[model samples]
Target: MNGPSLAIRQRSLGDLTAEFPLFPPLTRGCPKSSTDEIAYPLEVGYDYARVDPGLFDQTPGTDIARWSPLLPPLAAPTLGEGGTPLVEFEGIHFKDESRNPTWSHKDRLNRVTVSAALAAGAPGVVVASSGNHGASAAAYAARAGLRAIVLTSADSPPAVQAFARAYGARVVSVPAEARWPLLREVVDRLGYHPVSNQTVTHTGHPFGPEGYKTIAYELFLQLGQAPAAVFTPTGYAELLYGVWKGFVELKLLGLTGTTPRMFACEPAADGPHARALATGAPAAIVETFPSAAYGIAGPVGGHRGVLAVRDSGGEAVLVTDEEMRLAQRDLAGQGLWQELSGAAGVAGYRKLRREFGGPVVCVGTSSGFKDLGVGAQTYPVLEHPTLDDLRA
Candidate 1:
């Protein structure tokens, strides 16, 4: 769908300006102070408070004393990511993100990041993505009237390439290892804003995950309480971190009594988060291998993934390719045809269903088109066999 679409039992986060719990405060990782920095002239008409980290993070105990411009309140036509379907299945709930503009949950991050780019007066945006993120960035940039450059793997799925081009992004194909440095140069040399990430490590942009907070907010509003557990398919683990942080902030603000246990579902070929949780370390020292679920084939979780798992009383689980394929079939039975990685959450729920009591949400991250290259296929030639010819 070209426009926004959400298929949930209708509900809303009414009066986004109304008093809710303050965002939970967390330590800001900014530098001590600016030294040897010359003052530059400021631009007018843009809200001066837009650049403050608090505008995005909104930590607890924050005092909004000044007239800070908030994100335009969540309204209709959300591009199908945040207000996804919260359907019931044998008492378990599913948050289906396939209905988004780009057919993935990445739309949430790109929406928030694109807004930040526009607010900051950026000329355009650049990103390095295998699929969903690039399409999402491109779509949002088109909406915002900014140029978008997508540095993607040469081997990206054709459907994804078509999606990127359809949204007006300049698609640049490159090797996996070569893409990052090129993206950095694009930002430092070309002045195009880096929306994906630029830190030496996998520290993504400050405002990117802010978009993910809406998922948790929707969960509470939809169910009228926190779930007993929540599971997500993991790659960089940004969504996992966002959901956990959102709930923690909610608890701090007295919006919820407690946070649910978050879980990461990884493809067994490269179960980095699972390994990291097993080792009890902040970082997982491993390498990713190619798999059917290309979206979740990362070597390890990003900077904040481990912390999210630890803080939310969560653990990571791995599903084999065969199991994931079976999950795809199972979800199809539920009338949800998702990508291979999209089935990871359902696979996790199937494994751990007996342990949980209250409502559980399994996040379906993307549409099946994202991984159309990997799967079983069969074809038959025209035989023209009539009624009784094949019955014997």
Candidate 2:
């Protein structure tokens, strides 16, 4: 049986025109694109022609290992990362990634990134993240028996901070602009592996996004076919691009006849991915404002996202904080407690207000517990009263 990696070489996302050896993992952007001042990430190429179609016959089990042929070299143990459910709430289908091991879709990405760490014989892994990304990386690193370090913004959710620390990561809070530089130092001076971006733009670990492709494979199995369109919360757009790439691989394997229009949902305060898509640039950098949906809020945009939207003929949708609040409440009423940023997909769909020819899927990126103010709300409780109190 073909094991967890069929990856042969790394290909530049700039034009899918350049290739490099898969070893010495490219955590930063491709050299060609980096010289151009735009960080175009690399995608791991696989021998897809040799893949067995029977692999897709069954659902992925505890982790993403079931789709090993399409993934990069995974050297870590499974922590029950994949196998999330697709639940239909109200009118749209939600992929429900909060069910993942770390309670966020980022587990899928870190599963492979951490494997890259282990494969490289690194002592540990380091990342600069304020929320879900940090927490997921810590959990996966712990599972892989690697030391983890998480650099977060000062205002990162306390619950998330505790979550990462509980996983034995050395968690630190720094100024928003200081994380990446510190992380590079940790990688260079300390010789720890870096799982997050260390570029002018958001070019993350090449192998990690390959983990996200499993979502598309799982969705295809769940829906029995590809949905018409998929709306995903977008920050760096790695999740969006990875999901689109999964479907692209499926098509390349001669499985799916059609591909879904990939929608990139961003915070209205700072829609870098949306702006980049509209402007037709390879990537963009935009000024940001405060938004509660911080998980999907970013200043610099990555070319991977622009490629996903443009390639899929999909449009980027921007939603406001108020809109996300409504969407979050809506999902809560229906028994899914997603983070504010997690609800951006549904918010984007509603903002579009356009029905598709077939089913549309919305991705819920993380659990409500990962929100910036998870424990802040105070709900009034009734004192012991009687039937009258109940009636009132």
Candidate 3:
């Protein structure tokens, strides 16, 4: 099935002003209008006049690109990225995104961003990620027959590094602070389409988050109504913003009555979004400490996250490493093993004691195998096993 021919426009999040013809992914660090003071992630909006509501009624199946009227116009390469199972356990529904092709929610983002790279005629793609994002981007780029360069910190998980390399992507390890600068240099010199952020405030790829909207769409379709709240593990807040935007679009189309409250879950060691919200700033930077959930440990918070939380009447919640560990164990007991960072949503949900009174979804972003510490366990070795030892 082909998507409807729709014209794309770039709208500034700082102001309501929009510009036609989406060119140059990030204009001067972020999508901006002439009069905007704060630079924010440019929203990819469509001319709704050309859209037919009936088009959305078509079964999207596993490929999210099927909802093309609400997405950028491009032929995306899909590896069964979407249509993950929404499982219910202990009064909370879990959007198990670990079932994706790359075992992470990032496959949704990479599917669209890699297509953007192909549409723009870029040589390849470049991304900076410690784990899931890099692996997913490499997989998509490989599917599209394009070169992929993955930049990650030197201390990134070896399993994740191997996953990227297994997809035939060039993996480079650099200092945590040098990844972004090197990404920009590659984009400028090699003309590689950057699938990650290059700006100081972390305005991610324009087309990337649009893919995440499918999660919200799926939730509405499955439940036939909006949930009370959506808890998501946040780094740059791309998924949080994208999911909120999806709910807003549904309300705008009159398909849904209202949007759900969004919760941004971050590690307590580095809760830049929380800090930004407390300070009432568009963005904020903080010194990050080590945590078991390194995949979502971002030192800088972006304006996109703040907007999603504030607009949805939601708040940011910080979870400690211990809290996340407990949540991970809880998910495991429910037959869902998630990475420490992937369990942040559950941790946040537990931290917030308010009664939601309705269905609540916590996004499980990745599988437990992505964590570097997952492979360190060893079984006891015995020359002879006795009945007592077996019982013990």
Candidate 4:
């Protein structure tokens, strides 16, 4: 029950040369490589040698707090965020994150970020997301009794926006370009803790992805070892990197012999991760087009994502809207109605078209209810007729 963190410091992902203390978390990006104009993300560093080997012997519990030693200091109470099932569907493994409190994997990230806000004694948290991130931030901030501000675009999923507002968050609709700037002002001027990305190249909260590492721990427990490959639905590749980091920690602890290959699944319309890898950049920006899988169609890629694919010897695979649609339907056939973006992993896995010697996992990030237009259909009423009409 005592899951105190062993986190010591943070290292920059830009060049891995910059270092900073863990506490008073670097809400901004790496100071060495990041300026007001250019930004680079940082990774949390833990005193892994000090980690108790007995942690592996214990049953991986229902929430992220079970492995807090390997992560940053957790400051928020759990809303029952981890322990998602890794189910076999369509001849492959599917990590179902929809069972989380927010019906999305973002719950895991928020559990840590909101804790950062509470630890900093910040009054509220600010996030620039129109999807799961916004909703999850609102939910967790409310649970922690902190005010939340969600800045979204007008075209975001209606249900997702409703989720933020329903949680009593102050949701504001603004043009897409204005979100980050507004978020900056909220963080600096208004003194609100930013639970989302504030950097230009998508370095989210330093402690947020630490929350996502729990998924890998659960997978290791469920599968009895590391899988051969993990396919993640990536916007900034935070989940991809976090999962990889967990396995890396396991290997460092002399548990697993090797780590899984991390495959980042992104929308073809906006292949930030894929393009960033191709260019060998820490991060990159690309023009984006709206896709039904809106969650992973991010314009900016992150250093965390670049590190994940490259170090894991994995590649970024772009999935089309049609491909994801088929994958979504495929999951639905297996009784998992995931959001369109949630199907990116399976879509990427199928697109890879190579046989792996071991088990492969595709992450389903959210429920179908989080997608656009879930409850908007209006049905036509049938006219009253004779009882024989019913039989007909």
Candidate 5:
């Protein structure tokens, strides 16, 4: 069956109009050839036949026009996810994902994840996330008319819980150690499509990266040229892989002549990916000590972290919680509110500011609400309803 016709929408960033890349059909070796089955290069167990890469990209236009085509036909109720602002700061451009539908970059991944579920004939989708990814999956699944089951850390923010519940997803609270296994059971027993990291090597769903490639496609159109570099906050390094893959594909398609250097900013509390990159190992597993940037805190499962750093000519830099916190506060002063994980890109840039010579883009991965419950909380309460008392 021919899939639904994709909407080719144009987005206007200032005076420049760019089209989102058309979604190409899935084929062996990432080509649209006469292959009977979709073959992926990921070294893991994946039913490649169930995924279609076409739902990932569309011609860029306004946020509506660009993402409208990326959504399913008869899909309605848009909340403005895709066209996040590409903010410029100190010769660096940043994709402020604080503006995404649920205030995180996970929206991009879910847009395609839900589409894949539809193509695969799955009844629902499941993912385990501390914050953004589960919330985004829940939102998109609701839009796709599919059920969503989110297995998340019980310690996650109330905002994240509210968002998932708001979308009608069944939120299963579990200890962090039990999340992945329970998610696996749900996927196996109920046949829900799993969107979380599954491999010991960090290789996520074969089709999920297709959604992330749109970031590079957007960068190319928005700047009218590729920047000198693109930086991302790294947890499992999925976003890093997605952006690099997109640029590599673009270069292959003859749409771009040069690829930008990619960099990953990782929290020092769990810098396994950085350690792996530094040691030339297949993958690095660190004894993680959690920090304020809970979004990017975890033991990286596989070697994709090494792969992302090596392939993109990227270096992984470690940022302390204090550094990320300062970066968060600085960004908020600019009217860009982001979570600690979301601000890691800026932290990376600040660390290498002396070395960076030209245009750079750092991805601010999510809104600050995801981390509001991370530490001590205090709020002043008004004892009396008086304007003068409030002002005082």
Candidate 6:
């Protein structure tokens, strides 16, 4: 993974201040400006001037760790998380992230964050997630020979719980509000790495989203140019910001003519990003309603997502549960079965049918198997019947 010499720094998303080192994995919300009302997330900043765009010209391999120059340096093990297929169906390009090792886009995030844990010499990794994040973190921790502890909601899907336990992670079912506070205690007492958000506002691990930048890099190489738009399912908007940052870097390196419009797709039941954008606020806390797309039902919005949407001339789009269900079925009809949240990008595209033209990319972020009620539907079966009986 050797490349040009690299130095990593932490920058505040609020004022673009480079005040912190990249190590120790900072996740605290950035300091707020006197004039501003809220603090922003800190981001992992690289010396992009030293990066060679030619390094990205090569077709991406199965290992995302190969993009080490753009990411924080760590000796993390790999499970072939990146290089997912970019398939076209119904006039849209789909980045099939569900094909990743852990069957979700969270695999990319955990790949780097777990590396941060190992680099910091932490005893283990801890995460609070209802589904994908916990499962992915647990698997990566196992790969790196570190203990894993996951705090999930008591009502988390059986499959997600099983997946984490299968990887030898200690899965604790706790109240929703208690997860973050408990994670903080674990980090303080046991010296474990906290991979998810612990702040009141969601400033996730600084190095985690760097793993998702590979999606934009892959899209460019696969299409030979940047698409007109990219729609991603948004929870904390980590993937949304990561993909947007990737394209921004390409333009900075004289590789792409223009960046795509980044769309942060969220469940309408709880669209904190959309609410923040609509209200002209740095962040928003929205009252949430139940939705089958539980994976993306984040109650709070973050500053990173707002920056991504505003900078890229993108907008936050909300899709209803029914819209997501229809989109999921449509993908299944085309032989791509995604979880309801994974289909939010497509649902958003449908909602904005008249807005954009030209090539568009929508990321299918996870597999259908991650959905809690995915297998509840069944069809009647008849035995000992002939073709006539079947027709009747």
**Candidate 3 lDDT for residue 250:** 85
The model with the greatest lDDT is 2
Model 6 per-residue lDDT tens digits across residues 150-269: 999988898889999999999999999899889999999999988998776678888878889889988889999998999999989999999998899889888988999999999989
- Candidate 1: tens digits of C-alpha lDDT, residues 1-392: 11221111111111112221121101111122111221111001122222333333332111111112322212212344556778786578888889777788888878766765665667888998888999988988888788999999888898898899998999999998888889988876886777665433344655555566667766776788788799999887878877776676557656689798889988888877787678774446376666888888777454467767777887787887777788888787888888988889888878776676678999889988778574436666548877776684
Top candidate when judged by TM-score against the true structure: 2
Q: For candidate 2, lDDT tens digit of each residue in 1-392?
A: 24656789999988567899998888887987576568889989988878888888896566888787888777888889888888897777999999999999999999999998998999999999999999999999999899999999888889999999999999999998899889999999998999999998888898878999999999999999999999999999999999999999989998999999999999989888878878888888899998999898878889889999999999989899999999999999988999999999999999987878888999999999988876989987887868998897
As for candidate 3, its clashing pairs are: none
**Model 6 stretches astray by more than 4 angstroms:** 2-5, 31-39, 355-357, 376-385, 388-392
User: Candidate 3: where is the Cα deviation over 4 Å?
Assistant: 5-7, 18-20, 31-38, 58-60
Q: Tell me which of candidates 1 and 2 scores higher on lDDT.
A: 2
Model 6 / residue 246 / CA error / Å: 0.4
The residue pairs found clashing in candidate 1 are 23-59, 23-60, 24-60, 25-60
Writing each residue's lDDT as its tens digit, candidate 3 over 1-392 gives 44663646777776665554576566334444322334577878877766677765755468886777787765567898888899997788999999999999998888888888888899899998889999999999999999999999888888899999999999999997898889989988999999988766767787778889989889988777899999999988999999999999888888888889999999999998999899998877888898889878978888889999998989999999999999999999999999999999999999996787688999999999998766768977977989998898
* Residue-wise C-alpha lDDT for candidate 5, range 125-190, written one tens digit per residue: 898887899999999899888999998877888878888999999998899778877877887799
Q: Which residue runs of candidate 5 sit more than 4 Å off their true CA positions?
A: 1-79, 374-376, 381-392
Quantify all predictions' global Cα lDDT against the true fold. Answer: 0.67, 0.90, 0.86, 0.88, 0.70, 0.87
- The regions of model 2 sitting more than 4 angstroms off are 1-4, 379-383
lDDT of 4 by residue, 1-392 (tens): 45788989988887687888887878778888886545777788988778888887766556788888887777788888888888898778999999999999999999888988988999999999989999999999999999999999999988889999999999999999999999999888998999888787888888888888888888898899899999999998889988999899889899999899999999999998899899887778899987888888878888888889999999999999999999999899989999999999999999987877888999999999988888998976668877787687
| Alpha-carbon shift of residue 226 in model 6 (angstroms) | 0.8
Name model 4 segments beyond 4 Å from true.
35-38, 383-392
lDDT for 301 in candidate 6 is 80
Better of 1 and 3 by lDDT: 3
Give the winner by lDDT: 1 or 4: 4
Steric clashes per prediction: 4, 0, 0, 0, 19, 0
Q: Return the number of clashes found in candidate 6.
A: 0
